[model samples]
Target chain A: MNDTNYTPSVAYLGPEASFTHIAAAELFGHKGLTPRPTIPDCIEAVTEGHVAYAVVPLENALEGSVPLTIDYLFHGGELFITAEISTPIGQHLMVNKAQKDFTDQLESIQSHPHALAQCHKFLQYRYRKIPLIQTTSTAAAAKYISEQPALHIAAIGNQLAAETYGLHIVEENIHDFHFNHTRFVVLSLRKEILDHKNHAASKKTTLMVKLPEDDKAGMLHQILSVFSWRRLNLSKIESRPLKTGLGHYFFIIDVNESEDHPMMKGAMEELAALGCTARSFGSYYVYETDPSSE
Target chain B: MNDTNYTPSVAYLGPEASFTHIAAAELFGHKGLTPRPTIPDCIEAVTEGHVAYAVVPLENALEGSVPLTIDYLFHGGELFITAEISTPIGQHLMVNKAQKDFTDQLESIQSHPHALAQCHKFLQYRYRKIPLIQTTSTAAAAKYISEQPALHIAAIGNQLAAETYGLHIVEENIHDFHFNHTRFVVLSLRKEILDHKNHAASKKTTLMVKLPEDDKAGMLHQILSVFSWRRLNLSKIESRPLKTGLGHYFFIIDVNESEDHPMMKGAMEELAALGCTARSFGSYYVYETDPSSE
Candidate 1:
């Protein structure tokens, strides 16, 4: 019954160069891998058992939550976060070195929509309207642009993407915000590890719960009451609408203890009785602050 | 010497059919009006005095925050939420009536990238690879597909958009979430408003605050502590990167009171003294909960 007996394939949103894909690979760290083509495909793969695990992005500091990820979590079936990973955004102005006039010589700025968005001011100052087109992924934009002309077009992307497409970074760390970090969640057919060497890491469990139909008043208070009564330290609680029904919603809470912890187990039992769907996504101490090289 | 002596023209983020445009019309209902191309242009109009006010979408109930809107508030000169309005998601599957079996014979889905994302599952179940494409606006998509000979392509848009584009509503209320609401804030050339009527109709005051450079934990707790001290009810608090230097962040707080309300004004004064950037938008209370009728 141990994980050592399992060799389940892992699926993630990818083109082999997506930030999500990169985060997934890093989260898995050389485990069984099967990169899927789209976010939904990865969700479907995990739901169908085509793969034992899947990885997707939840939110970035710049952009709050990945609406799709929230939708996937709310819409029922597919997956749950087995573990969470925080990825840093150290984007740069990537371009093919063949073109000159690097400083203020941008005709068009290109990258994944999200990247283009995160560096909103830089583009506003430099190339507001030369046509900020889209690519399938940041890597795709860099690869496609580097192949032909990098004259006036520059792609703002991460260093990994710049390296993958063999492009030079014209300018480094162009993100308007230096504290940018994206929280990515790992989902698998199996459960994540909770026991850790450190005491601080011992009491952490992630859960997603669906609120009852109708009644929006005192929403958070009602959800918190369950945790407070159980003496569970409800460290974080966020709400995402249940994508299907009206007035129904999903509440994700980060508790300060393992499910195996005696008191926390009692809270989970009461929470389960509330008709709330809860999942244990490993218990480990997460970096309390955004870590950046800047 | 008074706002009563001057009535300012405002440009919003859309045409007649866009939600921002509708919000502009609603906020500036009888106020002076000017139309603009993009959100930034509207902000520019306000900043440069081309218009007196510019309305921008700050956040959604389902999606945490509009990243571009937040970024604009961070970079654009001297702007803050002058007023707030909440509009429910009026989602519809709009199609050219020429297409007879629209659902059974559908080939593609078109809408703004966000709208497309919001209705991801409905399309996934109904039409898997039916080529979900993005447009500048949902109205733009509706307009674009109106002239196309391909009868199978349809757009998911708002009711006003469908009516304006002369498209038929093949399906009503198609958004994945039921309680979908987008909250917009009006930005102005100047900080203060003209009259008490504006304040009387206002039920919320939205403010932007930057965490002081001090590295004390619970800076947010400190910010909220002020409101708690005054027994002020907070509607929501969205945390976003400050878009300035490293490790710095900004918080957008929506409080349940008009700007003129003593509780809110006192809190604003305290917040400013704590190195907060506060701007009070004119107050109007319009809480439309019905997603379809809106």
Candidate 2:
């Protein structure tokens, strides 16, 4: 009876109807899609062979890096980033269908703090005195509001959340900033899991470089110089705690080049020789998903 | 009636006993201390001439940069960092004095999300099934627990929070990492606010640099090269979003040099000519506070 081979199993950070779910559904078409409660759980599903791949939010255009995802990728068991899904995040002010007309009676506005913060201006102008409640996730907040009908509570989440939880969207694009997008990465146990469509807009190679412990001064500068002199254009560079101690950090550099490129390889080798532990996270395609399609 | 002119006025992010308050008291003592609800409020207190100085957290060892403080420094207003205070962060598990002996009855565990996350291991091992709640701050949680006695609620915060709120420390140093430190900055409208103690370990000059929008490639490397070739030691380098759009960033670099130093001045001039808009945040001394004294 355990013979579901036609569809590839995929996991995403979710409680269902989360942005991650939207991203996973956009990529995998909702077949064999499982929702894990946390980023680690999503990664674990892939590592344990429970799912062929996992999709987790790596960064938000507004919030910057998702530290949990970065930390897990750095310390957790081996997993490769196969693809990046960039989805335009549209935060919606939603309420239970029964209480949609009674929004003025809203005593509380509930959402993940990030979502609440993203739509802070709108909330401040519209419901100034409403108490804000923080939930584990936007989807979780939506689910809670749906379960407790006519409670005069509103949740700020995505369109998918409103649809999934049977809530009515009172306002769309309620985020303070319009250029909001969340980058979700597809993680796999194998090095490369190419998309069948392969209609990627761009390619990037991400590297984790830990500087030499003793060589204190200009070590980071030297590492960057190697990449610079080689003419490798860096799209992003972030430093996460090494977790060993304070002031110890490992740089995550996203180079706009493929992993197999000569300049990228040269930079990695030069960085290694400089007593820096440089490792390739992966060379992956970035797919900008059109929110309209979903 | 208001003739108390002996103490200098200072503001901090607080309900009275938050970590920012501790840092403020450690630097300025208790006299003329004002507690502001948020980071922006604390900064506004300084900028609006409500206080001589405002103490705010800038970065944490485990968590990295405090985005609010960074953002305010970049865009909020013109405030100079007068001094840097490095405090040892000790997260203690506390609860109402009435429920000190009945930790097993705890139905909920609460703290700021960062504090809660820091004590994740301890919470998992001991209060595995306890529902975790997020408050605005650890001190706020402690304050809430104090007001609602015997509610089977526990809070994770510093020692000061426990004492201030009349709670008992059930577990001390519950944070998983031992070497945790939070760097707090003293912000003032004036360029300098020297401590009477005249004891500082080192001096650092922080510069905010924004690359020319069009000159994309190798711009960051060139900026680093300016400091690297000059042999100026860098303690910290962080990139905050310009907020203009995605992928646009402005860097904050801390150099181990005085602002007046010849080489440092030369580097700043070179950066200016390189088509980068560079501004001096401040050149200030760093103070390592003794937790034992507190």
Identify the candidate with maximal DockQ: 2
lDDT of 2: 0.78
> What is the lDDT of every predicted structure here?
0.64, 0.78
> Candidate 2: TM-score?
0.82
Candidate 2, A1-294: lDDT as tens digits: 023467879988766888888888887877889986556657778988999999988765222226657776777649898888888879999999999889878899888655765676687688878888866578879999999995989999898889889999998898765655677889998999465564465689878888888877788888888988888988777766677876788888889889888887788888888999988878998877776864
- Model 1 DockQ reads 0.18
lDDT (tens digit, per residue) of candidate 1 on B1-294: 135565568777665577776666655553676656445566677887777778766656322236566666665547655656667777789888787455677777887656766776788788786888756567778898789756788998887788777887888888776656676777875666433223335466666676667634444555666777677765555555565543466666666677788877788889888776766544545443234446
Q: Please, what are the lDDT tens digits per residue for candidate 1 over residues A36-132?
A: 6545667778887888777776765322236566666545544555566667777788778776456366677676555665666677786666677
Fnat for each model: 0.09, 0.28
State in Å the error of residue A134, model 1: 5.0
Interface RMSD to the true structure, each candidate: 6.0, 4.1
Instruction: Report the number of clashing residue pairs per model.
Output: 7, 0
Q: RMSD for each model, in Å, please?
A: 5.9, 4.4
- Candidate 1 chain B worst ten-residue window by lDDT: B193-202
